[model samples]
Target: MNTLSIVIPALNEASNLPAVMGTVPVAELAAAGWRTEVVVVDNASTDDTAAVAHALGARVVHQPERGYGNAYLAGFDVATGDVIATGDADCTYPFDALPDLLRTLVDQDVEFMTTDRLHRTNRRAMKASHFVANHALSALSRTLFRNGLRDSQSGMWIFRRYIWDGLDVRSAGMAFSQEIKNAATTAGYRFMEVPIEYRTRGGEVKLNALPDGMANLRQLFNHRFRRQGGRGEAGIPAQKQRSERYEAV
Candidate 1:
């Protein structure tokens, strides 16, 4: 049976880890013909994040460098699954929806599947300013990259592990999410976005909205022009793929 590595990058999220980890439907995924391995990347948290993850039966990989992308890169290196899935350690993303998303990924023959939290995001889950910023960034990304991504900053993504080898994503911070999606689409891989419920987080929010948003804007422009020479080498197979919303059952 193929394995699915659920890699979660956590930074001082000890209070939120349990709720997040508990919702991963390991048995359901197993029943769906995929064995699940939860890999938690401890991003140099001062709290008991590593211990909490371990106690919850997660394999903890310690990443001394503290960045969102650094933690994910570290977790990806240690993940032992053919298929890799990502979600935040904070309880905002729905881990319980993975089995359904995985089924959609395979059935649709998608190489990279990212979730859209912006479509159905509640006011309680995201601030109005942050929501506006997300929309502006996503719009710019679509215009620059010519890909139909609704949420450029969504952290939840599921994709074939081999695709990572071909991607040229280099962002070490919050901009990594947008960069990875852009890389995958630019590489002519099949990509899709599914809608998922965005919940209010359990711990203190870590995003420095203004600075991170500005950095993401810069990264999008930089990445777009950097790959200009090799833009259509493979052609965009993802564009030919559909971008329908996934209605959860």
Candidate 2:
């Protein structure tokens, strides 16, 4: 029975902290032959985010680097589980949906799982350009290298420990999300995507739309136009071949 270490990267999220902590089913987790622990990577939050998480039984690691990727990596380095599950702390991602990711591994024996924000139930605040960007990037990723992720920018993901252990997480900022998918494809790791809703953040979005969007576009083009080796073949080892059959996440 392996443990599950949930890495929650947060930045001044004290308001949402208690709710998230209360939402997770820890007793059920322990009963299922699974030990559960959370590592909250506080990205220089001025509030009591770290203190609150500690009160709720989460180990807080302060990551002064100030980026989603860096905070996630900070939490990952200290994770104790065989599988690392990462998600946002702003309540945009449903912590209740975590079992879906765990079930994916049991049922499919796959290596990675990323959530799709375009799920059926929740309403999306997608601007026209954002929708276009999502589709365009998704299509390009499939066409160019078969990354096969419907939502490259999705914040929720569960990854096998070995796959992450073998590779270096070099992205220090938002673009790192796309960069990981780029790296994953070349590495022959099995990929899966589950649909998760994306609601507007309770507070303002931490993201800067024009700049982040442009950065995403640049990464996409780098994948589309740049030499194939970095994004597609930088550090990959041969693995098992893909099967004809598939399971929907």
Candidate 3:
């Protein structure tokens, strides 16, 4: 039986964590041979994010840095599981659909699996500007990395823990979403994507479309042209240096 750690990166998501935690089907997962642990990585939130998460049966990992990438990196370092699952704490990504996704990952034995948020039926869940940017980024990623993934900005993913060892992830912002995929693809990891519903966020929207899009674009180009020869060197851990900056909460 393999362990699964579902890591949710939250920043001031005090109100949203309860619903996210409540809806997770922990018992069902355990019955299906996965000892699931929900980890809420609080990214220096001023609100009661950590306290709320702790009360809700989630182990809260505190990350002082304030980036989507930073929060997840911290969570990954602390996760004690064979497989790592990632979703947003804002409730935009569905927690109910995780069982099927996990089944696919296990059945197919893929190294990397992500969801396609573009198939979402809710028209108002995503903003028009954000949708456009997501498509542009997806196209750019496919062209640059040849990964053939539809959603470059989708936050939901499940991957083998050791797959991180082969990746040289450096993005500490929104760009981390695309950078992880690029690194995984470059390392020839098996990849797959399934459709998942994208809902409206529970709390406030945190994405800055223009700046984040520009940063993702920069990440794509940098990864394409820059020489990444020694980062994921044999025996070295994934994002080793980056993980040192964070302290346990």
Candidate 4:
């Protein structure tokens, strides 16, 4: 049976995890031939993040190295599935969209899919400054990497595990979001974007808008100018590489 690993990076989402976990359509996912496994990365939280996830029947991995990228990289290292889906633990990204997101990946024959929250249902979902910063980062990505992405800062993404073999993911901070997309697009991975509804998160917002924005901007320029010699690829032919073997961490 095909496995689908849902990776959720949580800081202190004890209250919010139930809502997110409850929305996962297990029956539908099973009917569609995916055995669901939810992996929650506890990113060094003071609250009961790990306990809540364990009580809810999720495999919790404690990541002492605290960063958005570090949490996700830890999750990605341990996810045992053909396809991996990532989202925020704060409940900003919709859990109900997983079914469509998976279907779109199969139908379109794409390796990577990310949500576009530009046409969001909740107007107050994102601050005006954040919205502007996101757009600026997206524009920078398009200019540097030439991928027509509308939302570069989106935390939600789904893709085949093997795609990591051809792409380099080196960021250990918030800039990792942009780095993954840039590497994927630069390596010519098939990409698609799904329009998703954005909502206000239940937990305390972790994003430092100005600092994170500046870091992402610098990452964009650096990636465009840098020449990665041999570490870019997985050091093997794409067809020769094992589909299940992932070495991102």
Candidate 5:
């Protein structure tokens, strides 16, 4: 079976960990020919978050930095799966949808997948902030990267290892989402977006759209000039992560 590394970027997600863990239908994912491993990226959390995750058989990693993408990059450095899965730890995205998400990645033959939370099935269930930010980011992505994005900032994404070729990414915050989307357009890599429901965070929300929105807009222009002008080198294949040993899920 091809391994799947499910990375959840969390900050003080202690109370919600058990709930999120329960959302993953283990049998469904296992039956899909995936050996699942969950990696929790802790962003300097000040709680028993690590202990709780370890107790539930999840591998926990801490990043010295404090930001969504920073935690993601830290987890990326440790993943060993051929395909990497990233979703927020705030219990907004349903982990039970893993089967569907993974299926789209393979059936579509794409290296990148982003989920649209406002898609008919989930829009009725989403918070206003989520609906607005997704719309804003998606529009901005289309303008800058020309990727025809419907949910550019969605934390729910699955990426094949090989798509890293011809891409150089350096954003350390929420900007990582736009950076990847922009690179995909420039590199001409295949990407697909499917719809999923969005629920409110089980705890305090870690995001502020206005400021993050500005950052995202800034990234779009930066990427446009950098790609259209003679700036970045062609993408290179992503290297295999050093941690080959299985960490408990």
Candidate 6:
């Protein structure tokens, strides 16, 4: 059976792990011939994040460094699956939609699949400021990279494990979300976005909208120009292909 590694990065998210982990359709995935390897990266949290994840049947990986990308990279290094899926441990992303998302990934032959949380988002799930920031960043990303991505900051993404080595993602912070997506698209991978239900978070929010948004903006321009100067591609890969279908949930 094929294996799917679900990697979640957590920092003081002990209160939210139960709902996040419980929503994962393990039995449904198993019936579809996919074994789920749930990995929760403990980002040096003071609380019981690691213990909670372990008790909830997740393989806990210790990431002492306190960066979103650092935790995810650490988890990815240890994940033992053919396919990799990523999300946060804050319970904002939809884990119950994974089974159907996995089907879309396979059926469409997509190399990288990211979720869209902005479309039809619940008002209570995200603050107005975040929604606006996301739209602005996504607009800049689409304009700079020509990737046609709607939600560049979405935390949930499903992709083939092998593609990780080829993509050149460098951000170590919140900018990691856009960087990874840009990297995959720039590497000529088949990409698609699916709409998913976003929910109100269960724990304290860690993001500083102004600073993080500014950092992400800088990362975007820097990445685009750096690639253009070094590879002469200008963020647009010659072999890139858009997915035939956009599966909506």
Clashes of each: 0, 0, 0, 0, 4, 0
Residue-by-residue lDDT tens digits, candidate 1, 1-249: 879999999999999998998899998889989999999988889999989999999998888878888787778777779999999998988999998999999999999999898875465688889988998999999999899998899999999988886776677899999999999998899999989999888888989998998899999989988744332235422221212221101
Off by over 4 Å in 1: 227-249
Q: Model 5, range 152-231, lDDT digits (tens) per residue?
A: 77778888866654456667789887777667656777888887878767888777768987887787777677634322
For candidate 4, give the lDDT of residue 111.
95
- Give Cα-based local distance difference scores for all models: 0.86, 0.72, 0.86, 0.82, 0.76, 0.86
C-alpha root-mean-square deviation, candidate 2: 7.9
Candidate whose TM-score is highest: 3
lDDT of 3: 0.86
lDDT over C-alpha atoms for residue 123 of model 2 = 43
> What digit string (tens of lDDT, one per residue) describes model 4 on residues 56-150?
98988888889888888778778888999988888788877788889989989999988788765655898888887788889878888888888
Q: Record all residue pairs in model 6 with backbone atoms less than 3 Å apart, i.e. clashing.
A: none
In candidate 5, which residue pairs clash?
A: 165-236, 166-235, 166-236, 167-235
lDDT of 2 by residue, 165-223 (tens): 45534566787777677667666888777787665565546877778877777776675
Task: Give the range of the ten consecutive residues with the poorest summed lDDT in model 3.
Answer: 233-242
- Model 5 lDDT on a 0 to 1 scale: 0.76
**lDDT of candidate 4 vs native?**
0.82
Candidate 6 versus the native: TM-score?
Answer: 0.90
TM-score of each: 0.90, 0.83, 0.94, 0.91, 0.87, 0.90
List the lowest-lDDT window of 10 residues for candidate 2.
240-249
Please give the lDDT score for candidate 6. Answer: 0.86
How far off is model 6, as Cα RMSD?
7.6
